[model samples]
Target: MALILLADVGSTWTKLTAVDSNGSIVGQASAPTTVGTDIMEGFNSALSEIRGQTGSKEYSIYACSSAAGGLGMIACGLVPELTGQAAKLAVLGAGAKVLQVYGYNLNEDDLKEIDDLRPDILLLAGGTDGGNKKILLENTQALADKVSPLPIVLAGNRNAIHQGSEILSRAGFSVEVTSNVMPELNRLDIEPAREAIRNLFMSHIVKAKGMETLSRRLAAPLIPTPAAVLAAGKLLAQEMGELLLVDIGGATTDVYSYGGIETPAGMVRKGIVPPWDMRTVEADIGMRYSLQSLVEQAGRENILAQAPHQEQWRQELDKILTYPNRLVSPGLEGLEIIIAQWAVRISVQRHAGSMERVYTPAGATDVLSGKDLRGMNTVIGVGGVMVNSPDPKGILTMDSKGLLPEKPRLMLDSKYIMAAAGLLAGSEPRVARRMLAESLAAL
Candidate 1:
């Protein structure tokens, strides 16, 4: 008979659900997010209305995820190729929208590009462990000197920590330092930086968005939309044995997989693991927002590279980039199918790359061997882009060809905000598990 409130505050909408003990959604509501205004007031108003309808049962937990006020970030690296890629991976992993990336070789115009974007967080990472400290340090110094005092996460050479911290602090910038993302030429350790990034979001980014005004009124910390997704993914995986979740949003496409488990001591009762058994990847390929990034990655040449008509393919991509959020018209119907297919393919590939990197530790022989395409049991798809499409056939086309690995049984998210359910699952496993099952059934 327990009732739990789950909410996902997206950039455009705030979705809320009230789930009963048996995992049935007893109540649900949606509202436009009051960006740049007091979020708490809007949230409270929404919750009050839901509570009134559902009956005032004591809520066991209040869980949330947010993408409001833009979780924008800029990534800086020593080498444009290596660390830049790593920085992008980490940024995506943390669930923030990366506005731009800069490397040491980036010229004045590059710096200007980042400055113009006015990102909330700057992720600066470079150099392998005990590798070139000079390049990372110099880049950090240059960025500190040029950029306004934004929250900077230094996840580069471990040796450069004290010096980089001092330099950033001297420049009056708030800085958090973590382990080298590229600890070795062949290995990348992104957990520390990922954690620091999430903390920064809670401490600085949310505050900047004026979410703190609302968060202060709440009991728990205001978590970024992506972090909450990660949290929920972890719980789902642990509870259901193993799981894969795909979130295709308007701005980015994210894939999260959770496999294996080692239950913690105190957390045995409450299913919160100190570290997640989950791996996440975010591709800036949404129906809107970073639609251009999707096009760039898939490449006009690569996507059209195989097309029977090159000019037509190019023209369609242009149209998609121009009107990313527009519905597929009769004329461009085929083209929309092509674009969605390519976007899903590229997005899934990126997700696989992140999963392989995170799950397979350095020199681990039997890595991801048991669970490849053949072993995956379930794949859940979330977000409006996937669930709310007019043509189930078009959605199924992507699911069959683009979104999932070959072997898994695919399901759509009947409730769009599973992350919120996941967060509560940490505290109330039985209730959360039931709700998740109900959600799966509804889908």
Candidate 2:
């Protein structure tokens, strides 16, 4: 049978899925990520498992990766609020870990930090079409002095791209010029920058350490794992109106919200420029690797409220933190489930904007600063704990404290299909949509 293969090379585990050409999911397999050795070993193992299960070896593969700590990115813009924030959002929206963000022109300390961070790619954006050339060029020249070999995506003032490119090129840096991320005052255009980041992910990231062979074997451009998730989430939201995607992993809990038609008043009231999609990564709120930080951030009370044995669980977590690879008996599954609940609860709250009353000269008014997710209709859960848990729905019900989505239906990506569907979205949108609908149906 003709088949399509999709995989996500994640930090801890590599998930692989096989789908028939008709958009039906066929087989799914996973293996511990082989980061210590050749990372391709994990892929080989997963592919072999998939072939063995499906009883065939003939298939085309598409993949995305969050291995090697994913892609690290830094964006520099002229203004702190307008263009700079847009650049930062674009970087996050593209699934890169934000190493640092510089709103104003780069100084000595900033350059030193960028060099220390050693981001895989740097995004430089500022000004509108014909506005603010001085700061863009000033920032460009400053970058030329320090960031010698880094690949810079020049997405600033339209009029200054050429000059910026020339300066950076002369300084021995590779420059990819894209349209301004903030082409106008209240207009944010991030597609070009997002595409640039993806190109770098495929061209530079996947092939960086020792995976050249794996990179060459892939048929499609390898996307950042979060980007693939976002792509699949966006498509799902298109079909199901507004939707929220919660993915809880070992190291991070990522929330992707696709606000399609139904939007909160915050989008207009806060002067949000081109508000449609949002992706937030809560680094301190994961289940395994970040349990300590999660506890520190979410507080002990929040976790105990979920009905988990507190003291013994805390001791196990302490051991797990130090000896991460120790295969503990699976008796702590109850605590794990409670951790998942906190991950979803806090990550969603962080991803969403809050409504605050402002005391202005004109009567008191309310304003929002982030993407409001209260209007989303469904919360789709993806990951092992989310899909496997019997009461994933209960965890997803979210405490009634924050600006919660009212009566939103709960869905689960039971087949581990979100990342795979995201990888297939660009080439075979029909297959992606069909696979998502087939497996991730509402509960």
Candidate 3:
């Protein structure tokens, strides 16, 4: 029987899954993601174990990675809220943590900050096609020869991309030029830039994260782990109809919502993208690295209300803060569940939009901002929190009550196979669909 392999090399663990042509589960394995030295050690270790279990050497391998702070980026554009926002959204969709955003121009201070941050990639975008070219050209000139070897995705004014590309290329830098992210006002085209980011991650980010060995061994381009999961979520949503995905992890919580949104008649959405079939990563609400921020947001009142032993729980969490990899704490199940719940609440609150009263000539009217996922029928949970918790669905149903209007029937990705299925999505659609259906069956 022909076999296929899929893996997600995450920040703490490398999860490996082996499936057959029909998407039948063969075996699975995991190892601590080796980061101190070479990452290939852990990647190969998991692969070897899965191979040993299946006893098969001939298989196609596809992988995604979120190791070592996956794909940090800084975005620059002509306008802070316009094209810059487009660039930010584009990179974020490509599984990147946009650390900083700049608009108009880049000076010595900006360059220094970029150097200091040393982002995985720089997404430079600006003006609509046939619009302002001064900022894109000036920014390119300032960045030329300064940020050498650091890859830049020039997705700016189409009229100026040629000149900007020439300037940056002459300065000994790798540049990927894509079409304007905002070809016209209120028209955000991010697919080209997103594709560029993915391609560049394969070409340059692997080396940046010390995954050269794994990169060389892989049969196809590696995807950012978050992007891989988002792809899987999209595919599953298409098959199963509208769905919401909340994946809680050590460093971040990502929420993916899929559906076709109905816009108000005659009103154009200019403030935010529809974000339909899109993913949002909440960097400040994880179980470990962002635990403090989570605590601050969730508040002492909420924690005490849920877990009365707040002091004890906080103490245990403090220890885990030092080492986020120790996500599973024995005898601290209650605390972990509560933390995951808080993460779900805060993350979903941010991921989904709300309506507010706005004053107009006609009087106060309701204006909706962001994607409304109230009508979602399926809610899939993944990551350590959902997979390990005894009551994984509780995190969404009980804690995510206010944010999610209607209770979404819960599904869990306990096998850590969703990302693997996402990897398969590119190669075998039928198999990917079947595997995800199998996962959702547990709901």
Best by TM-score: 3
TM-score of 2: 0.92
lDDT of 1 by residue, 1-443 (tens): 55767767767677778877666778887776766675555566677888888986576555455555457788887776677767776776676767787777556787677678778888888788788888777866776778777888899988887798889889988999888777776355678888898788777765334466556644465666776777666666665555667777666677666653332232211111212233434446766678788777767576676556677767766776788666654554555555555666666555542112232454432223111322346667766766665442344333433223555656766766577666565566676667667666322
TM-score of each: 0.75, 0.92, 0.92
Model 3 weakest lDDT span, ten residues long: 260-269
Instruction: Give stretches of model 1 more than 4 Å off.
Output: 1-3, 20-24, 57-65, 105-107, 207-210, 239-243, 258-284, 288-342, 353-375, 390-404
lDDT: the better of candidates 1 and 3: 3
Candidate 1 is scored at a TM of 0.75
Number of the top-ranking candidate, with lDDT as the measure:
2
lDDT order, best first, reads 2, 3, 1
lDDT winner, 2 or 3: 2
Instruction: Estimate, for each residue in 307-409, the C-alpha lDDT of model 2 and write its tens digit.
Output: 4567777676667667756544477766667777888888988877776778879677776656666667898998776887767886687854545676689
lDDT of 3 by residue, 1-443 (tens): 65888878888788888889898889889999988777888877987998799999887778888888888999998877789878888888888888899988898899888888998899999889999999899888888846655799999989999899999888877899998888987577888999999999987776334477666666788898878888898888777788888998776889888873655554333365555666778888888788878888998567757765777776776777667757555777887777788888888888777666578897766666567677788888887778878878677764444336475787798676888889878778899987877776455
Q: lDDT score, residue 130, model 1?
A: 83
